[model samples]
Target: MSRMNPVLSFISHNRYWFVIIIGGLLVGVIDDNSFLTRAQYALQIKNLKEQISMYNSQYGRDEQKLNELRRNPKAITKIARENYMMKAEDEDIFVLSDDETNNNKENETTE
Candidate 1:
């Protein structure tokens, strides 16, 4: 064979190492289950777990409130007053806006 080029000689000497490096790159970056994909999957799993815990806590709170509503007449009235702006026939509901409260405080301070 004609004299091999220096580049070819180097590559021939380390062909196995080159193959291993390229293979590692392909597996780590190009495959479907790549390192990056696995990392993203792990992050998604972590987020889902957090959502599950948050929803579980919220469910527990709602369930407790439901039980309280079933057992206590006051709980139903409180929920109605707080959430639905409801009141008894004789009760007065005072709806105070923040701006009104602020103006009142400013007027008091000025006076």
Candidate 2:
């Protein structure tokens, strides 16, 4: 029999390993639904779950505040006064800012 070339013999010996490496690359990185794509989808799912949990916790806190507002007249009044700046007709609200206070002090000094 004729002697086989060294390159052909080496390729024939490692043919199965070449197929396995090619198959692994296709399944792991080159396929449409690949492992790399699945890992990215998993990360997006994790972030969406975290956002859902945060919104749920915020909803719970808002619900507690609503319940408190509904049950207690003082709490309702406090929310109205602090958020809406509402006051009774008999009460005179003095709204002062730091800038106004500084201007008043400057005017006093000039006088």
In candidate 1, what are the lDDT values of residues 1-111, reduced to their tens digit? 345787799899999999999999999999999999999999999999999999999999999989999999998889899999999999898997766334434556665
The residue pairs that clash in candidate 1, if any, are: none
Q: Global CA lDDT of candidate 1, please?
A: 0.92
lDDT of 2 by residue, 24-55 (tens): 99999989889999999999999999999999
Worst 10 residues of 2 by lDDT: 100-109
Best by TM-score: 1
Candidate 2 ranges beyond 4 A from true positions: 1-9, 99-111
* Weakest lDDT window of 10 consecutive positions for candidate 1: 100-109
**Residue 40, model 2: Cα distance from true site in angstroms:** 1.5
TM per candidate comes to 0.78, 0.71
Cα miss at 82, model 1 (Å)? 1.9
Q: How does candidate 2 score on lDDT?
A: 0.90
